[model samples]
Target: MAEVQQNTGGDGKKGQQKKMQIRVDFTPMVDMNMLLITFFMLCTTMIKSQTLTIALPSNEKVDNVENMSQASEDDAVTIILDAKRKAGSMEVDTVNGKVVPVVYYYFGKPGGPEGLGDAPETIAARNNLQESEFLGNDEKSGKARGIREIIQQRNKDVLTEINKLKEKYASGGFGSLETKEGREKAQLAYDEAASKVRKDENLKKPVIIIKSTPQASFGSLVSVLDEMQINSISKYQIDNMTKADSVMVIDYQNRHHK
Candidate 1:
């Protein structure tokens, strides 16, 4: 009887052991999951969205005549920023004029020879010049001068002067134009362009119209504006064709489940 009882006890112990076999040790798995979560949390970046601040024209009511003639050829300057190129390029266009190539110089890189210089001074000096100088002035000197001819002349003169300065710098002359001076000159050239547009006889009080793609960043726009030396008298407007009544509707019931 004692032997039989012992056998029964041993059978019970085997059954308990078999039941315990299915149990898993999940502590290591839990620890690994925690570690992965922490790592991902630390590695992930918290992206922040930024909104561009632009002053829009007031929606005040005006006389029909005033509204009809709000923008005169002389009153507004148009700047077109196109990022559609394989490498983005900015072009400036006038009310009734063809697109003119405008170069943008970054502080650190070797930009095109067209646009480069420092701040307000160079730009201010440029503004004093007549539009004919940029767009092309008809030479009264009985010489044939088209817009392209004038542009070429200006480019040649500018490049010649710049090359001389660069050569001087290479020769280790202390009086040579430094990088800062070059940047300043470039900015002055851009401002001069803006001034020409504003003072153009073809337009009245020139309004600066900027046409930029959605892909264009605010920094690019700001840089151009800064170079132009635009002030309180100038007005900036955006071209958005979307209607105010447009609304987006989504239907969730029709969505497919994979």
Candidate 2:
């Protein structure tokens, strides 16, 4: 509510002035401001979440050999993601302030010639589980470290060409980098060049098969996928883990926890 008080200024033969004092109650205004602030807080978009798109093969059993594309042992890399678990239990293990992700990788196949073997003893012998972490780019060289470095090494042929394309994009070779539209055009050109690099027949590339345990965090899955994009990997798929995968993980943890 607002009110105005009138006061007489001065009196003269033929001139007089009147003054007005306005009193405004700010209680309602404060309430209105709070409501507006909350409204915007609820409506505004904060951090945009990133997602991965994966295509799964049909559930139907395929009996034809000619239709299947088989990857040779030399070209396959199997990556397994698991959460840090208790010593010998299935409990979620965390260290510091974050959920630690344990990575296991093998050059080819789940198990060697004797494929997971028959018992836990043989499984441990055949288990190729190795531990790694999700680390960021190096401070000085800006080169990716940790598992990223390992992946980049395997996909060096593809990434070598992609890096050239990235350089070209940054230098404004595709279009002017000053404007948004030009940036978009440049990005499209870079993507096409990167795709061509991935499809190059002369270069050798590894086909990655990513498997995750149920206890693995979604953030870790995204981190691994980010490595694929950063390295310009062409062929990769998210697959369900098998019994051998579980046995290997548990056995490795049990042996190491001691």
Candidate 3:
């Protein structure tokens, strides 16, 4: 708001000029600005930051060797990450200046039923390493491909239970999903139930052991771990590649590439 003040001429002089002053009130404008800021703060929605959560290995020591938990041979699955190699050499192969990743996996053991013996002939004959790709879902069918398909098949039991839980949650078995508060509560309950199913002793879940070659990119390792999470796997660990693992890989490349 603005107001004008006029002063009368001095001593009633005919030629004297009148003086004027203007005043503005900004308090109302300040109050309106404060209200606008408050309205935006209350009505605006904030975006949540997306992140990948991974469980790290514990540093606690065990007193007894027998007390250590081990995966059963029937349920063990080993995945090896490696870079693509040239036709007959150890040189890494690249496509469009990007290192191509290779995935290998085996069930039960590295050298199949007989195990990896020191003899070269035995390794050549019994090596169970099978190559695969990091293919995603097929566009037309929406079905998983390559390594993702393998993990999903091995983790069928846990995934089946998780799917059942999803159905139950959608049907309001855990809680109502109508309101924001109700949705949050329902999600918490669903997560707890899924965790229990993953850890259940009766369920037949595969224990995955991830290994990587020295030339393998860190990105490849992360990709394999992503598969574990996407497939709802609970029993998995990152481990060092053994001598036998190296032998099998070299022997495989030699036989196949040549």
Candidate 4:
């Protein structure tokens, strides 16, 4: 009985020892979980996407134009006002060395020298004479008449063309002031001129550059802007010196020629 008691105690002690042994093997499992997380992170390149590149201008010290006298003509639209008529003309000269004319057409007059009459009846008379005399039996005459018809179809066409240019420039795109119809009409007008049609390659719209003398009233400048705004050119750069860099710059030295 004593021997049996000793064997039973020995078995109990062995069981107790077995129970005390720590058998937790979490190291391999932890390693596997870490590997899985790292693998997924490396494979997930979708988190990185392409981004747009834009050049940002620096706010460094640059050559500054103190006033209208220091402003450059290259940065302005030069306007020469002919005192003979109360009306003024505009020209667009860009910083990139491009110059274009901002041509204006009278509301009722056909856009040409011959159409420069005091009244609509005079314009009609001029058209009649051109149709009967210079353009007699010629295909050119027929084309000219067609162009006139297009201009006369609606005054809004000209305004629409001007609006298109304004929108283009406002959206950072270059816009031509001349429309296909306007150019065609201008061509017909030139043909009717007494002298050879001196084609103005420089004439365009939207970014009209002009120069007005100091004697010119502020109302004249406002008038030009009004015309542009009416045609939907809401944004414009005036050719003058201002406190803001975004505003137009004027050059007194360049104004000597006009």
Best by lDDT: 3
- In order of appearance, the predictions have TM-scores of 0.25, 0.78, 0.75, 0.21
Model 4 has an lDDT value of 0.34
Provide the lDDT at 115 for model 1. 27
Off by over 4 Å in 3: 1-72
Distance from true position, residue 170, model 1, in Å? 32
The collision pairs in model 3 are none
Per residue, candidate 1 scores C-alpha lDDT tens digits across 92-161 of: 3333333333321111111112322344343333221121112223557643243234323323433344
**Tens-digit lDDT string for candidate 2 (1-258):** 999987754453345556679999999999999999999999999989876786666655572231133432657787889888876677888888577887888766666645778776788788877777788799999988888888888998888878788888888988889989999988988878878889988999998888898888888999899888878888887776767777887787788964
> For residues 43-141, could you state the per-residue lDDT of candidate 3 as single tens digits?
987987666676656544442222123532767888999999988789999999888999988888779877889898898889998999999899999
Q: Give the TM-score of candidate 1.
A: 0.25
Taking the candidates one at a time, how many backbone clashes does each contain?
A: 23, 0, 0, 8
- Model 2, which residues run further than 4 Å from truth? 1-35, 46-48, 63-72, 96-98, 113-126
Q: What is the C-alpha lDDT of each candidate?
A: 0.38, 0.79, 0.86, 0.34
Q: Which stretches of candidate 1 lie over 4 Å from their true place?
A: 1-34, 39-45, 58-75, 83-207, 212-234, 239-258
lDDT for model 1, please: 0.38
Better model by lDDT: candidate 1 vs candidate 2 = 2
